[model samples]
Target: MNELDLIQQLREGDEHAFKTLVESYQDLVYNTALGIVQNAEDAEDISQEVFIKVYRSVHTFKGESKISTWLYRITVSTALDLLRSRKSKKRFSFLQRLFGDNNEPLQEVPDFNHPGVALDQKENAARLFKAINQLPENQKVAFTLHKLEDLSYQEISEVMKVSVSAVESLMHRAKQNLKKILEKDNEE
Candidate 1:
């Protein structure tokens, strides 16, 4: 069925439709959460919370935009809110111990099952993720929605509740920041 049909089913309180919706977008939701929280555990928790929020609020969706667009907006908002809450905690001693002052020399995760990812690729992904985590919240969200999720500027602007020009500027600055970080990593 089409997304509109699925949404109509959801609006009619079809539990199966809700599950289908969740199953379809769970990865997008989880990855967005992961980008914000920067911890798998917290991301998982926030992803669950996002789905719950969606369940409660799905009826409010007016179909003015695609359901995916609405869901992306909800996902990004929830993730950013979680990040903002974490920022108010007053300390990052845990991170200090994990990444240390220099930020190079990331700890490795042994994933024997995924030979597609070379060790270097894994390390690079980790470093990239760490760099992303350091970005200002808006830039991080903009970058993740664009770079990681492969959403277009129009889609991202809709999700972020920003103008297309604003999304373009955000993406431009995010690329500049990420390039600088990668160049520094090369030197190290």
Candidate 2:
């Protein structure tokens, strides 16, 4: 089905349309979330939440952009929210560590298995992602969307609500940042 037809079906509460939408976009959603959060379980939860939000708010879609654009916005926002919540938890954990009563260790993310990467490249991809996690949020998002999600500057501009030039700058900075991070890791 075409984009508008599928969107109209979704808005009209067609179960088949919803199913098609989910099946069509789930990998995009899951990969985007996984790239940011770097956890399989969290990415799965975020994918479910994204679909649920789409189901609940389909009527509000203004159709100014494509449905994929809408999905990108929602997925990015949801994934960033999860990261913010994790930051908050890490802060609390820091506080707990600062105090005398030590309950548990700070959460450590295991090496991510990037679905898009070749088996031989998994280690390098994991290192890249580890460095990526340390980047500032905007840089990280821009990089992930461009490199991992394979989005163009124009598409990223649309999803991020920024100008195409801004996306370019972000990509430049992200690349520079990643270079520094990888170099540092290699030196160690």
Candidate 3:
């Protein structure tokens, strides 16, 4: 069944249709969450939350856009909420350090892949992910939904609740930023 048909079935309270919908879009939702959260465990939690929200609010989704677009919106919003919560915690920790005399270093150990792994495409992918991380939130969302998720400009615009032209602009800027970062890396 097409997405619209599946949505209609879901609206009609068909449990099987809901399962099919979840099965179809689960990867997209999970990956999007993973990109934003950058942690597998948190992404899994956020992905489940996205689907629950989608199932409960599916009735409010007027068919103005594709079901995938609606799903993307939910996924992005959930991830953003998680990011905000993490930021708040970090800020609180920083404030606590300012008031307390505990001089423990805040360290994050990088998880190194096996040294036997060649630095071919993996390095490029890492560079690309780093560059994507540096993008402003809106541009990052547009770029992630477009290049990473392979959503069309129209679909992203609907998901982001922006004009198609605006999405195009954000994507263009994102590409330019990535290109500049890559160029600077090459020069170094």
Highest lDDT, which number? 2
lDDT of 2 by residue, 24-99 (tens): 9999999998898988899999999999999999999988998888998899899999999989988988898889
- Clashing pairs for model 1 are none
Residue 147 in candidate 1, Cα distance off native in Å: 1.6
Over all chains combined, what TM-score does candidate 3 have? 0.83
Q: What does candidate 3's lDDT look like per residue over 13-90, in tens digits?
A: 899998998899899898887776666788799989988998898899888878777888888988988878877977
Position 99, candidate 2: lDDT: 95
Among these predictions, the greatest TM-score belongs to 2
In angstroms, the error of model 1 at 57 is: 0.9
Cα RMSD (angstroms) for every candidate in the order listed: 5.7, 1.1, 3.6
Off by over 4 Å in 3: 101-104, 107-119, 179-188
Report the candidate with higher lDDT, 1 versus 3.
3
lDDT per residue (tens digit) for residues 158-183 in model 1? 88888999989998888789889888
Q: What residue pairs are clashing in model 3?
A: none
Q: How well does candidate 2 match the true structure in TM-score terms?
A: 0.96
Question: Where in model 2 is the C-alpha error above 4 Å?
Answer: none
TM-score: the better of candidates 2 and 3: 2
Runs off by more than 4 Å, candidate 1: 91-119, 182-188
TM-score of each: 0.78, 0.96, 0.83
